[model samples]
Each structure stands twice: as structure tokens, then as C-alpha cells.
Target: MASVDLGKVLDKAWADKPLAEVLAAPVSALKGVSDRDGELLDEAFGVKTVADLADLKYVRWAQALAALDAAK
Candidate 1:
């Protein structure tokens, strides 16, 4: 996949609409994410919205776990 400048798209969209609209938009619009990641995120975490990504406890835990694992 190609690189996507999500922040730029979001800034432009937010100027024309509500924050909810921007968040509800597809994750594909974001930068550097493959179709596979979107599908897996939707299935594994039910992360349909950008807002959902913020609330992912398992992801947060896993990130921390990876950091610890790498440090060892």
C-alpha cells in the first residue's frame, strides 16, 4: 500500500465537518496501514472507528509487553 497522510486529511475534513465524522471515517484513510491490518483490527479488536484505537487495552498492554520483552 501507499503512504497516507492521515493528519492532513483529518485537518482538512475537520474544517468542513464534525470531529465525529472524521473519527467515523475508515482507517484506510490513515497513513502506512495495510488492508490486512484494518481487517485484523476490525476482527480482533472490533476497532471500527479511530476512537476505538484509543481505547484498546490489549494493544496498550501488548506494546508495554513488547517493550519489556525487548529489554530482557
Candidate 2:
């Protein structure tokens, strides 16, 4: 499985965008997200981007994993 490159997903170009705007992007923009997982994320949690995946109120595991990944 490919790893999610959060740096690319959360690129400098996205820095000025609102959180909602950032999260509105397609999940495919996230490095490791397969089409199937992206669909599941959207269907199950409404997650469409890195920000959405990192939302603590929704997918806590994603947030935790993101943190762990960042630490590496």
C-alpha cells in the first residue's frame, strides 16, 4: 500500500484556503488513499481530504494515525 504524503496533500497552495475549502478536495489528492478507501471515507465519514480525515470530531483514528505518521 502506498503511504499518504500529507505534505503534498496539504501543500503550500492550500495554506491560504479555509479549512472547509481544503477539506473539500478529492480524497485522491491524498497520497495513500485508494479509490475504494476514498469512497468508503466519503460514504461512511464524509471525509474527502486530509483535513477531513484529520478531523478529531469524526475520524479520531485517522487523526491519530496522521500524528504518528508525522512523527516518523
Candidate 3:
């Protein structure tokens, strides 16, 4: 299993949470993401949680594109 230091990517309040909890947390729980940004994402894409954002089709497509570009 891979271990990551959540503190670096998550807000202080969320840093020590379990992976499931972290994934279920609001997008704003992520470091540097504000409540307004979360609301915008929600409004634009119906993304509310970290998992929702990760599962968004646009996000997946962008990641695939980035990976393909990196591989080229």
C-alpha cells in the first residue's frame, strides 16, 4: 500500500481523517480550495465531495489527456 502525508494536500482539520472520510469530505476540505470554489464546482458539475470531483467525467478526461501528453 502507498502511504501519503495528507497534511500536505488536505486542510489541517482534515489531515488526520481516515481515507474514506477524507474522500467523502467536501471539495473545500482540500488544501487551497475555498468554499466559493467548491460551490462553483458544485454548480457547474454537481461535484460536492472529493470523490465526486475525482469521479467527474471532465476531470477524468483531462487527466487522460494530460497523461497521454506526458507520455508523448
- Highest lDDT: give the candidate number: 3
Most accurate candidate by TM-score: 3
Misplaced by over 4 Å in model 3 are 1-3
Name the 10 consecutive residues with the lowest summed lDDT in model 1: 8-17
Off by over 4 Å in 1: 1-18, 59-72
What does candidate 3's lDDT look like per residue over 9-37, in tens digits? Answer: 99999999999998999999999999999
Candidate order, lDDT descending: 3, 2, 1
**TM-score of every model versus the real structure:** 0.51, 0.44, 0.91
TM-score of predicted structure 1: 0.51
Off by over 4 Å in 2: 1-23, 56-72
**If both were scored by TM-score, which would come out higher, candidate 1 or candidate 3?**
3
For candidate 1, what's the RMSD? 6.8
Residue 25 error, candidate 2, Å: 2.0
Residue pairs whose backbone atoms clash in candidate 1: none
On lDDT, the stronger of 2 and 3 is 3
